[model samples]
Target: MYDIQTIFQTANPILNQMPYPMMILNPEGIVLAWNRQAEKTFGYCAEDVLGKFIPFIEEERTYFYKDLWQKIIHSADPLHLESITISTKKGEIVNTPITLKAFTIDNDRYIFCQFNLGSEEQQDLLSFNEFTSIRDGLESSFMMLSIDQEGLISYANNLFLKYSKWTPKRIIGKTFWQMFPQTPESSVVADAIWKSLQNGRQWKGEAEKITKDGQSYWVDLTAIPIFTSAKKPSNFILLENDITDKKRLQNRLEKIAYIDQETGLMNRYRLEQIVNTMISENHHFTFVYFSIDKFYSLKELYDDQAEQVLIQEFTQRMKMYFQDSSMARVSIDEFVVLTPLGEWFIQGFLTYLEQHPIYINNSTLPLSISGGITKYPDDQISFTHLMKASYAAIQKVQSEGGGSISSLTKADHKALHKKSVIEKRLLVALDKKDLKVLYQPQLDLITGKITTVEALVRWEDEEIGTVSPEVLIPIAEETGLINDIGSFMLEQACLQAAAWHRKGIDLKVSINSSVREFRDKNMVKQVRRILEDTDCPAELIQIEITEKFALEAEAETSIIQQMKQLQNEGIVFALDDFGTGYASFRYMQLLPLSQIKIDQTFISTIQYQPKSQMLIQGMIQFGKSINMSVLAEGVETQEQQDILTEFGCDAIQGYHISRPIEAKEVEKLL
Candidate 1:
């Protein structure tokens, strides 16, 4: 089955240059190839040995040579005979040492023999039979393959065929690289092996290989380059042990410990490991964090099975696009990727999404993703700090309404660090009841007396000093701490109003509320419980809401119902910053609003800007026509206050009257 002529012809030049005799023979002792050196050593020409049995071994030693031939065939490793008696054409007998190895090509087996022609004084005799016995007893337990200097498979043992599922005809004569699947990693291994063998060095490692049917298996391989007397490599011998089972078990354990089962990507722990490794090596790379926008909202629409399918497809696309990067799934909707610095493909991915939208059940879901980038060894020195910095960048995008990408800046880092500290301390402050309330009074234009006071929550931390509501409120809401702060505001405002009523000082205390507060179904009950606990008259308490809350109330009927229930209990609702937001008459009609507060933005410059005066006047007239009172804010000067008074503004609250004060100061004012 083997192309014996081709193998001999390929090795013809190298064989002729050998310093010692070399011969190729079949299992039955017939000569196949007789090199020039073999002819000189045995006194036989190519014509005499061609297709013929050996005529060099003595008749008395013929039985011993036959026994040695059988040993070589059964042994996977090369065998050597210490001495053999040979008779040349001149009838002169000589003792020679030789080595022999049995090799298979296709279904045919051949023997390669090399003879040492020098005398005992010139060459030291080795225990060839003993060495062969030891090798046959131990090394034959593993599979073997022979590769020529050109790296083609000259021969492979039955063991290789057994484990590789490859027949002799399918494997023989092929280059070593052909046995492996075509991939970057496999190519790298093949190149390394070739280089090492060419340099006359032994190569040893564990390699994963593919079988005939595409199943993967692992092998512990040792390749030794076989050299000629010229100190140049002629062929390589490979000894391999199948390690598939052990590698598979190791892979399973690694999968459980380092893989995200949902998407088959690296998990958070694995990402941390890789990042730490990179940091130790001082390898500069960018860490990019990705978050799917409104992921939970989309997830709620699908069942668990469909969600998993969607997630798999999403990650598959990522793998294809970012083929060179390392990626990990850090959370349910968050993923991270590590790439060379300045080589991020996120912008390209965003563009790709525009052309290809992910669909489910024939419907295009509103899918958008955001990314944040941080450089390694540039932004942070450690993996934990790097991840935190990247997350801060992501938070910036999320806070700005998401669906975009951003990189961490020095300024952003400082601001985000401050925000984190504030958030943590704010929790402690709430627990300690360190937050206090101040009241800003509203003066009735006709009565010339304060009629209502707006309760504003203020926080002063021992570590962070005073944190403005503008900075702290958004953090509280984002962190879900606004519910606690809102509840505190309602309780304190009700208690203060009750105290003032008991003192014969009639004042309606208004407390601002966020739309998020009403997300809790127990908000109405909580307010009622607070009023009852304080024994405050419902008429003396007012809940001021912004136009944003009013806009949401339009769609969320439950919030509007809650407002009406509170209003029915004799509590009042005023739409604050009326002219500053959407200012939709629809929400104004949907909600049971007692009054509309003209935003300070319009009243602040009403005295100079006639357009402001016109808008203010129109707001007041509209409020009165709708049977709702009008109040103007930020009346900082008498001219501004008098202008509002002239415009028929029912009430005004600002510094022009008096700045916000504590409950004691309000008592004195009353």
Candidate 2:
């Protein structure tokens, strides 16, 4: 420690004698000091650089240098490290890693610095190699071309030169229209590209291009806009690929799938797809399915070639009427059309087709077609239902005698009357339990003592009190409410029969079954549940089915067989409304019928109508021959009962003794 100032002054020379470039700049950006390493690295002598302003690198490649300086100077605590590029004399570029430190000596600012060039040169060299390798190895027939905002080419690549058949020097700065003067300016593909560029959107399409030799070919081109940092498009990039053969194969496949080979119209598969799409999109469209009237007979009358010619001529005439429609050949003699029209337009079009006869192969074929028409978003919610409604309507027309167009109206009056009366009351009845079971005591005619009772359903409406079962029962059957009503009646009757069993009466009761209820797949299950719930002997519960309901038991053969099996367990079935329909005698052998109830129509007329008496007598004799019990219904007069008793009827149930009584009232009778 001999003379500290002298020792510090001696250490300064060694600090500045390092092998790397080093310089210190003041806060005012003036170069205050430099070393011999700085002089050699930057190609400036220390005497020439010490008092000069530091060179501001203005090259676009080194623009970030200004930003780096501002960041360090304005920061409250200046940073000590940064890497930057600087331009040298002789147009050479070098990168340097620098370390800086700020120190204040005399209330003014100062900075100390260090510099190194150890690893930066290697990084620059590696970056340059990667860029060149990628630029040379791309093989997608890519071209780097720049286009001005005014649609003029400013640059072109080598690949573009060979494809355009023009030298790069000549075509680099030409506008597209000027280079290909004969190209169609108003073509759809060209207009799309121009529109995209004007709107600053990317455009892609197949376009026709002409070479310098005037040879034309198809090319798929994609044009993308190059955006600046401000997000405004500065130029465009156009990439093209040859696609002629690909397009030809696509067109051939489409023809095979959609075009009808015989009629040259759209095939059924295409028509179905179009209809499905239209329905999915909720489009307002009208569909019409039609078939040639008597076409099968016409084919028999004429030869195959003649029929073909007739069909073609018929289709042509149909096309004339539905010019703006989608026409398809759905079958040999059936055609369908999808149009955007109202009912009036469709009716008028069909009328025109019906009135015009076609001339085919030097003969008048006099063809006519029957069609069904329906509108979209009105009649159905899907294509399947639309086709179903149309076909059902078309079948209705053809079955009544073809040769006219038909449209679906609301359900017919009979069906509506049935549905309205039944569905409205059945819903309310189920909630209110408005349905009551009326028991008509079935007597042994010989002893005149009640042994069994028939359970008849009587509807007591709150507003319209006590509706006759005849009117409401048919209504219920047609609306599919009969199954519910029948089950309710069965449950009530079983409970009453069980109560009668407890009272030592042991009287069996029967309930009527409708066509719908008898054919219901769940009929046996419902019956089993009620019997099990009530704990009634199965023999004490009989199901009374009408002769008309028995014929509809085809699909329910297994159910009918189940009923017979249950009959073996002591349940029974009576064929009610006997002699009311045809083939009553035939069904007796087919059905396991325990009893036959003669309808009231013949019973009330036995006094005046001799034919009624004879029919009743014949039914009784028929029942006797079959060894089946015959019960007479609607006996309103004692003379009628005496007549039934005289005829040796098994049971009598009518107003002559007592109308159907409720369970509570029948309990008193018991």
TM-scores for all candidates: the values are 0.53, 0.49
Report the lDDT tens digits of candidate 2 across residue range 271-315. 878888887787898888888888888878667577778778778
Among these predictions, the greatest lDDT belongs to 1
Runs in model 1 lying further than 4 Å from the true structure: 1-262, 267-286, 291-326, 330-334, 338-370, 375-406
Query: Per-residue lDDT tens digits of candidate 1, residues 448-514?
Result: 9998999998988999999999998999988999999999999999899999889898899999899
Clash pairs, model 2 backbone: none
TM-score of 2: 0.49
TM-score of 1: 0.53
